[model samples]
Target: MITLQDLRKVYATRSGEVVALDGISLEIPQGQIHGIVGQSGAGKSTLIRCLTALERPTTGSVVVDGAEVSVLSETQLRRARRRIGMVFQHVNLFEARTAAANIAYPLAVAGVPRAERATRVAELLDLVGLGGRGDAYPAQLSGGQKQRVGIARALATEPAVLLCDEPTSALDSATTRQILRLIRDVRDRLGITVVIITHETSVVREVCDAATLLADGRIVESGPLADVVTRPGSKLSQALVPVPDVGVADQRTLVQVSAGGAQAQIAHALYAIATEPDAHVVAGAIETLGGVRVGRWHLDVPDGDRAAVLGRLRAAGLAVEEDVA
Candidate 1:
């Protein structure tokens, strides 16, 4: 539902022209929840702005729902933007407006009838699990409640694509999970495409069907969760499925092995390691992502046995990374 072709954005600064995006080309299919993750200054925000036509790219095209967003006329963009809904990290609801009224604001702006707006607002309120809280003001609601209101408001217009910018960054872990589940629920119900921009790896792991890692305005890695996680020595793999730190003898060589897919594959990997007398498992983590069970293990082995252990792990269908730091 979204396509970015050779996208590039440059900024004029006092020092010089700063390149915020560098040749970023990506495609997100309809009804998919895609996550864009990176540290600050990685152009994540710039990329989202480009998608919304808020920040025009210096070069290349931005297409959403078949609209060439980057080149749209101002009037055209205003109309085209109706197909894109935005959810901010901060709820940004009007303080004086009740939750229901906040949700009605978008419809109001779009010239929706008051009676129709009321009905839509009510449905959105229930959709985000804020059924009766419609009457409450922002001040009276909890952080999670406010975000729900934000989500409801974003969905008020039933946009074809939902753009979430750090949607769960301000919430606690438990609340974050709740919001993530709500997003997934929204996707399942509406079948709209979702693009979540976040710095948190946990958010991507918990909610994204596919994820892209950005570094210095370039894509470091991008793919479905399963492909990225199971890739041999993948940077995304290391970040998403990190093995815990364990104190061990420095004289031993550390080898990291990861496997994703069937339960039997993980079991086989474990058995292979267990059967090796010289391989001592120091740390490990297992997680289910994209409906696949994936596991990563850090093993300490005698330097002389490193080759043999890696050979065995590879033979058992495990992706192995030797001499992991």
Candidate 2:
């Protein structure tokens, strides 16, 4: 539903040119929830802005739902924006307006009829579980409640895609979970493509179907949520589901083992690897990734040939890495 090719954004500063996004290229499929995971100054904010045409890229094409974002005229861009809704981190509600009014504001801007806007607002209020609370003002609502209003407003246009920028960062953990679930519900119910930007690995793990890891305005890694999370030594994997950190000495052998396949059962693999009678797993974890059972283990071999065992594991298509640390 979205495609970015060689997307680059540069900022002119007193010192020199500052590159906020450097050659980012990726695609988000229709009705799928994709995450752009990064830390502050990693270009997530800039990238999201570019996606919405809020910040025009220094170069490259930005296309959403078959419309070229870069080529859109002022009026064309305004129309294109209706097909893409945005939910901000701050909720960005009118302080003086009631929740229902805030949600109706978008329809109002679009010149929706009063009767139709009223019906849509009522439906959205119930959709976000804010039913009668729509009459309440933003100041009277909780943080989570306010965000729900923001979401309802974003959906007012019946957008094909929803761009959420740090939608849950300001909320508590429990509230974060609630918001994620709500986003998921929105996607399923509306069949809308969602692109969420977040710094929290847990958020990606919880809600994202696929994810891209951003660092210094570039994508360090991008793939299926499970593939990226279970990849050993990958930045995104390290952040989400990290292997046990083994304190290694030059003399001691610390071998990290990993394997993945839908057909290869973890139980069978555990029973099959018995190359050494004394070899035992010191640290390990087994989890479901992309509906497949995948595992990683840290093995400590004393008085044994570590290289031999590692070679055997690798020969069997398993990833075995020597922990130099």
Candidate 3:
């Protein structure tokens, strides 16, 4: 239940004013896992900060659960922030504190009683799959473990919204999946809205229900993950799932087959047949985009009259198109 309207954030730098966020407007539904994806300096970090009120916007309003966050007083914002929890890239866990204490720190600051804090910390430890590691310190834990602790701490207050800023950017692929699964679990169990900010689309594909693409502090595209990823020849599609960049040969026809699920399996079989004398596959990149198996197969045919072959692929319920590059 978060909505941003014409959001803009500007900073007074030595060279006039710099706009970190340029008219970013988004609505994240409650109990859904949403992703804001872009490269660094794309206003992803600034957007999240706006949500947590760590950095107020220069113009526009941020409404969370019907509360206009931008208009809140400092004291009101602090109280409102309790209902929103954030997880950072580096996880910033206190080295001196044990995992249990680290998770309990927030509650401790909020004046939670010792007995209550202990119970909450224990429950969170188990929730993050660190039940037996509460006694360990940050130095004694792996990168994933530290993040687990960070998550436990974030959920310590049972916030209605969870904002994860590059939550698994530092972890390995396997660990990243584990963390994503954990975030999903957190959303499912708590029924809380989850917003993830990442530079890579893989994270969104693995976990996000909806997504928005940001470039140069502006939202270039916003829609269902599947729609954005599957739109042929769109900037969003090319950026999210890269196709071959090389130009096609005049003697040979360039064909790209983009499909998902069962169609992808059939595409593999058809590509096997494309290895025949009439046509041959140049290069292919098969990948999962928006949680669906999709690929771009660059096929080269000797004759330009591949209309029959292309028609056959399309007749089989696959997406086939002639590629320009």
Candidate 4:
């Protein structure tokens, strides 16, 4: 539903030119929840703004729903923007407006009729699980509730694409989970494409079908969420799912193992060898990803037996690495 080709955005400062986005090329399929993640100053927010035409790029192109947003006229862009909805980090709702009124605001802006706006507002409130809270004002609602109102308002236009910028950053863990679930529910129900921009890896883990990692205004990695999360090469993946502690004791070998129905066998063999008093199982962790097993273990043994022990481990149908003397 969205395609970016050689999308470059540069800025001029007192010092020199700054490339906020350096030729970022990406494709977001329809009906998928895609995540863009990075630390502060990663150009993630800049990229999102460019996608919605809130910020014009210095070069390249942004194609959304088949229209080249970069070339659209001011009037054309305004009309095109109506097909895209955005939920901001701060839940930018009208403070004085009630929940229902806040939701109706977008429809009103779109020139939706009064009766249709009222009906749409009611439907959106129900869709976002704020059914009767429509009478409450933003100040009267909780953080999560305010966000629900914001989501409802964004959906008021029934856009084909939704852009969420740190939607759960302000909430607690439980509330964050609730909001993520709600977003997923809405995506599934409406079949709308979603682009979530955030610095939180946990948010991506919980909600994203695919993810891209950005650094210093450039994309470093991007792929399926499961593969990217489980792969060892990604720093973002490491932060999201940390490996267990494997202390390297004296005379021990630290072996990085894969979790693939072989953990029990490896453990048993290690235990049998460690029966020699000077040997013992130190630490390990078994993690499953994409229905495959992968993990690491540390095993202590007499220095004299190291070679034999490693040989036995390999012979036992396990991939092992000798780490210690």
**Top candidate by lDDT:** 1
lDDT of candidate 4 over 1-325, digit per residue (tens)? 9999999999999999999999899999999899899998999999999989999999999998889999999999988888898999999999989999999988888899999998889899999898988999899999999999998888888888999999999999999999999999999999999999998977887888888888888889887655764454455555545455656655455544222334575365545444535446566555443333445445665677767766765565555545422
User: What does each candidate score in C-alpha RMSD?
Assistant: 1.3, 2.3, 3.3, 4.3
Per-prediction TM-score: 0.96, 0.92, 0.86, 0.82
Ten residues in sequence with the least summed lDDT for candidate 1: 242-251
**What does the lDDT come to for candidate 1?**
0.91
Q: Give the runs in model 4 whose Cα sits over 4 Å from its true position.
A: 230-232, 244-325
Model 1, span 126-187: residue lDDT tens: 99999999999999999999999999898888899999999999999999999999999999
User: How many steric overlaps are in each model, in order?
Assistant: 0, 0, 0, 4
Q: Least accurate stretch of 10 residues (summed lDDT) in model 4?
A: 254-263
lDDT of residue 165 for candidate 1: 95
Q: lDDT scores for all predictions?
A: 0.91, 0.86, 0.84, 0.80
Q: Compose the digit string of candidate 2's lDDT tens values, residues 196-244.
A: 9999988888888899999999999998866774565666765666567
**Per-residue lDDT for 123-238 in model 3, tens only?**
99999999989999999999999999999999888888999999999999999999999999999999999999999878887898888889888998887766765665555565
What TM-score does candidate 3 get on C-alpha atoms?
0.86
Ranking of all predicted structures according to lDDT, beginning with the best and ending with the worst: 1, 2, 3, 4
The alpha-carbon lDDT assigned to residue 22 of candidate 4 equals 97
Q: Which structure is stronger by lDDT: 1 or 2?
A: 1
Better of 2 and 4 by TM-score: 2
